[model samples]
Target: MNAVTNPHILVVDDDPDLRDLLATYLGANGFAVASAGDGAAMWVAFNERLPNAIVLDLMLPGEDGLSLTRALRAKSSVPILMLSARGEELDRVIGLEVGADDYLAKPFGPRELLARLRALLRRSHVLEAESAAAAAPPRFGPFALDTLGHRLLRGGQEVALTSADYELLVALVAHPNRVLSRDTLVDMLRGYERDPFDRSIDNRVTRLRRKIEPEPAAPVFIRTVRGEGYLFNPRGGQP
Candidate 1:
């Protein structure tokens, strides 16, 4: 988190212009940037010096981004943000399924990409510090919130969570068993503002339920009020 020590990020994209643009853009934003055109070049840079994170393009030649992601995940826990021209829901879901920390579609704003990278790096740094200090995560509902580690666990096993899911869960758990309004949850997420009739909050709650609740259809942990927002029921299970 030191301004003096710029975080190194490797940008893997086949497009030369995109690579140069990202390198220039990210470099000005206080990040040490490296560029790779394909999977082979990515390894070359990785071997030269492992980066704090990787911005991988999903449509690489021969070995695609997902393949590299699966292969790298088996060896390293370094945070990865997958990029793809395909912005479908299925694509995003698949990317997260293969251990990606986050996903971004093509033609995204430089600022947005920078924000996502910073969040991922920040989470990684926090987890490393917590592990070194032997810190215990907050516990509730048969789950331990590894806030710094950015993953939930129950019965000493890792629980999968995407970046968005983890952030929302953390916000809810911080004020456990309390009714948090949609507006308040939106502020916590820092997401884009929506119309008055927005169901963004409900959508997020549904996603969280599928992951944490034993029965998503009849969710016991995250309960919804008819007119109000959702509440985190600590009755999920004994901590």
Candidate 2:
């Protein structure tokens, strides 16, 4: 890890000793590290400033890791990698289902964890660079998403976008009118192998529409393709 590319990572766990250890180890590896002892502390720290990625523990004091992960997924698209005890396969699977990007069982080597975190950050950067601009930006209704700027504007007014929603919308507009399966969208946006059973992609699309659609329930820019997936309608819901 290069000091110049100091990716900030938030470590959330209940154990004070382990939190300190992760901070020291990750910082030594060119990461700007922040640690929290439980879910409440995690929220306080995150609300203050978001990190590039989050390393969450499965066992927290009150709101457990799975619950916290699910809650965070509701609004944020920040990458999450969960840490659990060895033999916690069930916890690992559930973690993924709840929108955790990856999982590592405890008793793991610091080097291995570092490598995994680096890979996750790399993938996220790739996605951020996925949809570059052409001569003219693509338009969906009044909203025009600028891949180069990573910003959205509607009627010359800027639209608020979460990281997840921005990436999801870019993928859709880049392939207008084509039905993209949830798996394809997940793989493209997440920068990882598609978790076939994961519904997080759909969740993201829902959030994106609320920002870009006139009526989120009857979205014109992004249409649900029923069994297939979703397709972008360029004509949009023009009055």
Candidate 3:
């Protein structure tokens, strides 16, 4: 269960029946539920009140799920779980690549949806708590981690960070100049169960490098230490 009380969830789908069902089920399960029929409606609901998490459908009219996901990711780090009727692997990959945190195929059980949603919420809440628990906000290079606000600021401008990105960066910043292995990072971030070949950590590193490093192609802030793992260079000159 999420530690946050009555976390609001926005459900965006064209199917009115499905929308009502999810709203009812999620509301019954202690979530504040809001429903939207399409992309326009979703945006209206989103602007009126930002949701704790979003349940987006892939095949919405006007703006598709991938497009909406990209737009949302550009603005906020809110967790998004995308739903699609087609269970194709390519679709799932595309969805994830476009910034959907999790993907679910149609014909899924309500219990399974609840479980996945809960897991995402749990991770998000844990990240917030960790930030709030920090004794003092950490600073590195041109960035200042606003632990109390749960935000990353560079030159007073807030930088958008996903839950995974924020958690990974927090872990790296906490232990500067140390080579952290993939397994160690996964454990530290409380990452979802991943296969042996999962490159989630590496992907997150690339994303963070793009955001913070002077040269992402040759990163100085986050250096790859050969076969060991990654090392954070807080001073950020030569890695």
TM per candidate comes to: 0.59, 0.56, 0.59
What does candidate 2 score on TM? 0.56
Worst 10 residues of 2 by lDDT: 126-135
Better of 2 and 3 by lDDT: 3
lDDT of 3 by residue, 1-239 (tens): 12578989999999999999999999899999999998999999999999999999999989999999999999998999999999999999999999998899997888878877876876676566565546777788999888777789999999999877888887787667888898767655654455667778899999989989988998889999999999998999843
Candidate 1 lDDT over 1-239, as tens digits, reads 12126989999999999999999999998899999999999999988988999999999998999999998899888889999999999999989999898899988998889878876775565445445433667776688877667789999898888888887787666556878788667655653334656777788888889988988998888888767788887666445
lDDT of each: 0.81, 0.81, 0.86
RMSD of 2: 11.8
Superposed Cα deviation of residue 146, candidate 2 (Å) = 13
Pairs in clash, predicted candidate 2: none
Please rank every candidate by lDDT, starting with the best: 3, 1, 2
Better of 1 and 3 by lDDT: 3
* Alpha-carbon deviation at 227 in model 2, angstroms: 46
Between the candidate structures 2 and 3, which one is better when assessed by TM-score? 3
